[model samples]
Target: MIFDEFDPKEDKIFRLIDNEGQVLNASLMPDLDDEIIVKAYKEMLFARVADEMAVSYQRQGRMYTYPPNMGQEAIAVAAGLVIRHEDWLVPVFRELGTWLAKGVSLKEIFLYYMGNEAGSNFKNAHHVLPFSIPIASQVQHAVGIGYSIKLKKIDEVAFTFVGDGGTSEGDFSEALNFAGVWQVPVVFTIQNNQYAISVPVRSQTKSINLAIKSYAFGIPGIKVDGNDFFAMFLAYKEALEYARAGNGSVLIEALTYRKGSHTTSDDPTKYRDKGEETEWAKADPIIRLKKYMDHKGIWKEDETALIEQYRTEVDKQFEEAEHFTPYQLEDVFQHTYVDMPDDLRRQKLEYEQFLTWKENRK
Candidate 1:
């Protein structure tokens, strides 16, 4: 197995394709058909397009603050390809590509960011948790789901994602500890995108790498070249199979670069230098995947036209979300409790009176 060969303790990163799309580890290359590879590339491209458009909408005040899943596309896309429909996806906000793959509509995503609670109700996306905002909290949820699946004797694996910095949170360790004890089928992915907001990976831990954390939990771990699509795919394929075979959870530290600002409200220039950004840009996931396809003589379609088509589709989704019904005042408090407390009811009434008075004045 790849995990047996590339131990996280040794700080060895499993890589199939290099930055220029040259296959470095031919033996580790996944046995994906050429058509599937092309489809994967297109999915990655569509994700990038949608991500860029979301950022643009945020800038224009059409949508609220949004996270950009720019350079980290391959990690999510690979997992999406490997994940079964029966599997559970517990995401921590940034896995846009996987969200798309799991049947989350762009409109639903936009609605959530627009501060509407209805967006959290992903009716079409089966076995997927809502986008988690708090760091590492979803890791615990994923473990809980894994435990339940084990009890039910179901053939389901729980896949959870967190940032490199999230590994420092108490919940991160707690979840892994129990998951190890129970031997639940869970795949914990750490998207080590170099920074958690402004803090770099070096500041997160003194350990050689994030994947080594799996050692404490007695789970197999591997460090992967997150920008290489094939590498990420192969890692997920192996991890999923191992977990499905009743071995326990696996930890994957996807070494990638956050090519954009942490969110629409934050500034990347303040913490990351241009030289470092330029260096990472060369290893951009989309570029590497496209290069690989081009080399394989499969990427001969009209690229510009395809991108334009994606942009239009993304815009249509955003428009639908923009024109969706406005968030109701009752939605804020009504879902909090089965029976609204007297104080909460009073507060809601007060807000209603205030709105009425303001409307009359207008």
Candidate 2:
């Protein structure tokens, strides 16, 4: 009966570590070795560094606009830890941590955000889709991939991430419907970070919680502390296993907060409470994990060394990405098709002539 209260409709929030770095539920903790835990902590720090530098890059006009996942490091790190090498990841734009965990390089992310089409190309990467910007669209894609895995009788599970607002989109609902009907091996994960581009979860729906949406599709729905790494790891691990076992699909709603703007294009202070910022700050995911690591005597030099290592890596990668040639007009035409259509080829030529004429006038 320890986890008997974990039904999705209920408002019970599953948390392993409290805000003060205390374990609230030891019984529900996942089985992980010390090295794995340490690695998880390191990856969390790496992701945090990348998130901070990306925002600074945008402000400096060196990078394009992007969503920053500042307070949700635990959720992202846990996702990387939970899934096996064979499982698939369909991430939205905010999941840099997930990408890093799955072997995506910071240089590649920088290349993509710098407006180069080559960043979307993952020639050797396995099972991970390109980062999607459209909301709720990746859900069905994940289900579709899972359906293929099921058909091939391969042991694989696909995981897709969406936001609170994405749940309202018809595509998300359709994904759940399809997953339930066909019993595909997919996990629909929702990062209900309390806001969807300034819209609160309360404003989105009156459902008991986002996880409950899973029940309508006849699958189990789970809710977990998105800020607690242990809780998230356990939830995702179980969900992946359940789906891989050919049971029904699973939905996990990670409850956390978006500590920064939805993206460089929007502002959060226009609608969010200043007081709530203070409260979520106390529940900071990185701080919680750091405190827990220190208490366990696993944090060397208070993790200063680890931070410096990643800081150095990030800085070097950003510099390399910056040195890459800027976007070219021909790049745009080449990205759309292998063999350009006649109209597109003609337009490219016209644009080239216009540029040539302007230069001649100068």
Candidate 3:
């Protein structure tokens, strides 16, 4: 299935890949080199398996609270591939897919979510920020980084990830305003995963589309099919190049559905309709990508085999992560600040005294 016509637009949603394994725009189709395509496929599979493992760990009480990035695989992998090593990545909490693409080990993420704060260091993760769980806070960080880069005149861009609901945040608006006036090289990629927690997009904004909001800030924006790997890859590449060229910022609205709950603490079934989920399931991005690869003869392995490989890698990583020293009460004191505050120092001392007293009583 091949459809090749035009590129993505601001007012209209851009989708180069379709549900039936069709390439909507053949001319604009990115070079799906076998090596890269296969790598992308395996990465998507790994993201999926790792997401599933995160859920499993949470249920078994081995992991801390985490937001699952299950169905958002394609967008992350595509964006990751296009982003250069020198550029910075400003991320919200739910960007496991992009993290993998940036070459961060799954072990790092597994450790972080498993309650080891050391994982936050991300040893080799150059130019990547710590995960910002607060809504839209990372947008400001990206804008700040964009400004710093411009001051230094570094030929680098910053890609920031946000969500549908995050757009409503005042911080996002401020970031966009500053980015526009400063003309920084930043790309704000919104993962419009339809629903934000229990709130649907329709309930949040009356705007025709999310990307078009960039127009107010004198920047270009496009809404692409988040699930289509081809569209995601090309769109990100285009945006990255545009920003790097000093043409100001770009906002990307990736239209897709969150196939699962917002986080381990959430239950989508309580709010979303089953029918809606089934509809989105039919358009599973990974499945479509796999089909395209199979038809092109680049990916010949059976689905079962591929998944088995994914499970083996993911499971092994999970096992290794378990050996990390467990999080302890003292960590609260240890990690609070580099130079411990006096009040916190007093609190830690009190805690230690209490522990000693309890031990003596025993």
Candidate 4:
């Protein structure tokens, strides 16, 4: 169950539940009660519905550009299920599920995609940081937060989510090295979805696995089945526990697939193979858990229907969220600093003047 104990060629990949939800290895399974399982299931269900709604909203011009985490629910939910609320979560763009799992409200997420400033206003509820879209930029923030936590003698750990493509960035490597050298309590999670835009994983790096890169930094690395909830949960739990126990940092590579377009603006059909999509779809995280639940007699058809009903309610919330006014053009300068400087003031004025002139020309 530990990183060093794992073999890269044989035991690097762990699976407690298969794609069909069959319990493949019960030994590694985490102790979970019915209530927790049901809660996890609900979170996954809501995440799927929310992701779909956001995609739909974007297609209809109700929201701004958004990323889709269609087939990666288990990665978020499992991590969410294990991490403490006091622990800080730094996420990349494709982490809607993690946010929700960390107790972020559905309304707030929808509002964020809808371009409302109020959506990013969950300052007091959770330690969830704002979503970052600039590849591996958030990794540094997570490292800084973890360092601060250590300095303050807080029992807090930082979990940062990045993609396989983000690993190519210099910031990713620097963050891992900094955390490893400083022995900061941080976990760097790389969700290897196989593609960074049109670039495939094969071209991303020649390493057999992303986890193996951790060896250079003197930190433990793990590669797990991202679709298998139990595997992800156990792996994350182990890493988080290690960090909390003052074991420095760990790198986790969750081997998952995108299973859909990169985002609402992307078109996978252009570069990806159709067969690969179908193959990954068969390993759907929700279906895998449902199969296991059914086998254990814990899942019922009627209960699934209720879950769907709840999803419908989530959709309704998105609809209601859309009614709120979008962020004003000037509001963009507000969050960057406490007060606008002379340079920003002049830029804002120029932007306002451009808008005014356009309107007059019309």
Please tell me which predicted candidate would have the highest lDDT against the true structure. 1
Considering every candidate listed, which one attains the maximal TM-score?
Answer: 1
- TM-score, each model? 0.98, 0.95, 0.93, 0.93
- Alpha-carbon local distance difference test for all models: 0.93, 0.86, 0.85, 0.85
Residue lDDT tens for model 4, 138-197: 999999999999898889999999999999999999999999899999989999988998
- Candidate 4: where is the Cα deviation over 4 Å? 9-11, 301-304, 357-362
Evaluate model 2: give its TM-score.
0.95
Worst 10 residues of 3 by lDDT: 1-10
For model 2, where is the 10-residue window of minimal lDDT?
Answer: 1-10
lDDT of candidate model 2 versus the reference: 0.86
Which lDDT tens digits does candidate 3 get at residues 1-362?
11112223325677877798877779778876799998988888878888987898889998788798888899888888988889899999777878876767777888878768776878778789878888999999999999999999988999999999999999999999999999999989999999989999999888887886787787778888899999888888888888889988888888888887899999899899989999999888899898888778788668788788888888888788888777687787877678888999899889889999999998
Tens digits of per-residue lDDT for model 2, 249-315: 8888899999989999998989899999999999888888878877787766556776788788998
The alpha-carbon lDDT assigned to residue 235 of candidate 1 equals 91
